[model samples]
Target chain A: MSKDKLTIGTLLFPDYDLLDVNGTLRMLGALENVNILMISQSGDKIKSNCQVGNYIDYNFDNCPELDVLFVPGGIGTRKEVNNPILLEFIKSQIPKVKYVLVVCTGGGLVAKTGLLDGKRATSNKIAWEWVTSQGSNVCWIKKARWVVDGKFYTSAGVSAGMDMALGFISDVYGREVADNIALRTEYDWHDNPDWDPFSDKILEKK
Target chain B: MSKDKLTIGTLLFPDYDLLDVNGTLRMLGALENVNILMISQSGDKIKSNCQVGNYIDYNFDNCPELDVLFVPGGIGTRKEVNNPILLEFIKSQIPKVKYVLVVCTGGGLVAKTGLLDGKRATSNKIAWEWVTSQGSNVCWIKKARWVVDGKFYTSAGVSAGMDMALGFISDVYGREVADNIALRTEYDWHDNPDWDPFSDKILEKK
Candidate 1:
């Protein structure tokens, strides 16, 4: 095993979409020595929007410095947008981490962090208007499957996080590692970042 | 309410890849009144090969007849292929369920049920040879993201299951419902059933 150890923290909250968390985890965790810390505010068993539960590895107070911060979203992101404690916890870590990857409406949370104020980002298209409105200054890409502005990677929605994770892995490790993951997972990844066709359908209707 | 209640039993064995279960659940659970049962051999919390834990909703002995049977896979699939109890449990349910969906190496387990004996199917490309060999009479598609043979839908691997779920939802609910899911999840779904580029790359190497 390579002596490269990168600590990855996947933040969890109430009723987050398990697809984003699990699919992204499947990709990132495939990397060697990539420690995944399931961080939550209370360190409780995080209940997913899909009715599944996940045991939190650390509470906000005990969360260590991470190499990468991963945030997933669901119905909770709508309510958690105004949560000062979660916002503060996230804000404190933004400057210290190597990067940040936001999934679905997790972009809403990241938007609250002010990290995307001047950065290009994206979020779950179904809740596009509400999430994009959170940060007025951020340039929200209306037609992106995922966005990578500097070290920040933001995915469109739940399953899109899987694509973002594959891209993220490719960025961190290289094409071979990421391709190996897609091959192992038997996923034909639409690696093109500008692959979101939902924006036209969902946003146009709304 | 549409009075549409479909019980989706997601089979969880020891060391199953959590992605297959999580991705498919995100899509199916989005529907109204769709119950997801995380079934296992013993109804114990399954420990995934990736070191994650998922609690089971039902054990094999107590599992009810289902509308849909969902199966995921991992290293455990290789061992479970010979498991008579597990095979019998699957064998018994073949006639009772409305349809069956097998993801990744879970196809290996399904092949042991002899239900796919004359059906076209696929599995994780990395272990395609071994999994396909389980059902000698079965027509194993060399390049398919997923295959539909009667009441059975078998996906090539991990993330391909998500694509299959989208297609399955489209087939059951209607184009609009599945479209809504893809839009809401912001997933740029591989809707084409024949999109399996990795099989050429991965299988060719072997």
Candidate 2:
């Protein structure tokens, strides 16, 4: 990769989970040459589902070309997944981007864009069935911490977004860099690649 | 309390943890009748610590008379705790407010104002000493999830703010109302009355 820099863009929408977006951004911000952008469908600031005065910045049209695109899940994803403009944009951008990351039901949005067709994916437990319903060709991985089929990476709910982002960093730079980022952020990165939230262990513990 | 309505104000600083503030707001928003305002030092949009674009709405001078003032912790709190203007504003407003809720090291700011003198308090593990060093005659309960010394309520890290907010709601309203809010938000309320984050159980688990 050129020292010119790489941009990571995360889609933000009304009622989106602010932490998922932030956790990812914080991790990526630690990368020396990465530029992170918070983009929304209308490019206008949208209220986060967090309701505590959190918003996402930038609009889709104004966002710079991205090397990575991340979509995080929240109540907003229900409407966002079906937003034609957003879906079309993702479809147009996916092939050009080096990686596409989706967390929680964000996978649903990517699924709706037909990008995950014939690929393995995962999402929040509440939205797993809905994710499956979106595409018959996509193999919905029932027990996966994150599914990486080709350039697409997907993780389970909220906190899982942090894991996937770190994983992406690990892939691009190396595991050592990702570990340092996780340590600095005080997050415990689960090294088990096959960990899944829907497992009987997690459900039973909950 | 008459249904005169209580206005709750939360401060936003650059690099503030969006989740800590938003989680508390989400709980408060579910309440029957309350006004919530997001205030910043300058009233300009304050980016969160994550730099993902979450911001609170109002500025300090424009803040309305508040029934309660909530301060949430993040990397931003490190600077805000000692900000002269912010400390002055908080000192001026503390006498008028009915209650003050400080989450994580947000208590450091309150402590700076001498409000927590001869009181007990707790904050996130990372800042417990910093909180104590600020001249509060504080009984630092290491294992406590939250410490409520009279009208002052202080909690541990990020998610613990949600718990302390619910506790505040219970005090202002009733246990039933708090319980209902917790259920609605899918948060489990432990009725321990005190929260200590540094206990062996929490540390041992990690």
Candidate 3:
């Protein structure tokens, strides 16, 4: 990790959501002084929830120090939440990283670590109940595109990660930089953190 | 390639945009019984514009027959547009596929092949001039989130690819299926094809 540039380590597990990682990185990667690293358990090609295979850059043992830690959720989180190695790795990175961003069910994996116990967070509306159950003490906001509490940023399912990533940029870099990136990408960014429309619709189905 | 399934072969080159491919696939991949194969000049890890490396599933010569051909644009298109191997590959796939989906400067790559010579299309608004220059006879639309000309579907820019893809789904599958996929992904889908706002802003800057 360079002293001048921010290092972002994104965790990749089996069955990880493609958009949750790539969509968010699409915005964050535009930053001029950021080192993005894809980290998996074994540094192998991790299969996404969409069945796409992505080769990772680093693994648990050899990952360099990171300024930001990103975790993307998928069906994999259901099984990975119980994996001791992953839980321990999340716990290890919590205290060192300046920011922690969790997308979709990834909030469940991090919440299970007990670090966000008292912090306000959110997750995929589709998996709200399951994820909310993971952290009994965590303040889970149901109606949010994303929630930013202290050093933690958690977004709603899949595509909402992009918005959360932009919000993260707005806080760290400034509003102009984030807005410029959105314009460059031609992304219709929901600047408001509370602009969530799926909570009621998705929750009603259950 | 299974006869019963729709095989989608996405072309990858060095400096290809990550979200252009992944974001589009994030929507399309949700379709049941669709085969998604990543293709490149060589079956190797191709570096993205963001400096991310993605491993491809097939090389041009060995690629199986595809129902849909996808092309994503990045800085690589500037150099690749002149590359015969790539130009020939794009030209060859034009007549065989059921649909041709081009994202960003990918419109430039396909247009350079002369297949889109008389077709109505569009590309990244920021790179409007450069992309429009690729196909001299092509009818390029200046204002559109995406344009569907016959079998061809072209999107404006990076994140717009997701909207174009969902539009592609809505057209092919029923509207309900596409809407369900958008709901599942929790994506705020701009369902209208003419919902482009960046064309004026980006082109004016030039």
**Number of the top candidate by DockQ?**
3
Deviation in Å, model 3, residue B77 alpha carbon = 0.9
| Fnat, one value per model | 0.70, 0.21, 0.67
lDDT of 3 by residue, A56-101 (tens): 8999999999999999998999999999999999999999999999
As for TM-score, the candidate ahead, 1 or 2, is 1
lDDT (Cα, tens digit) per residue for candidate 1, span A43-155: 87767888776657799988888988999888999888989999988898888998898998999999987878999999988888889889999999999989999989999
Candidate 3's residue-wise lDDT over B73-171, tens digit each? 988999999899999999999899999999999999999899998889989999998999999899999999999999999999999999999999888
Candidate 3 residue spans exceeding 4 A from truth: A1-3, B1-3
Q: What's the ranking of the predictions by lDDT, best on top?
A: 3, 1, 2
The alpha-carbon deviation from the true structure for residue A69 of candidate 2, after best TM-score superposition, in angstroms, is 0.6
lDDT head-to-head 2 vs 3, winner: 3
**A-chain TM-score, model 2:** 0.91
Q: Could you tell me the TM-score of candidate 3?
A: 0.97
* C-alpha positional error of residue B176 in candidate 2 after TM-score superposition, expressed in Å: 9.5
lDDT of 1 by residue, B1-206 (tens): 23568888988888888788888888888887788888888986667766666656789888886988888888889889989998988888888888899999999999988888989988888888889888999999989998999999999888888889988988888878888787777676789989888888889878
Docking class of 3: medium
Against the true structure, what is each candidate's TM-score?
Answer: 0.91, 0.79, 0.97
Residue A99 local lDDT, model 1: 89
Q: What is the interface RMSD of each candidate, in Å?
A: 1.6, 4.4, 1.1
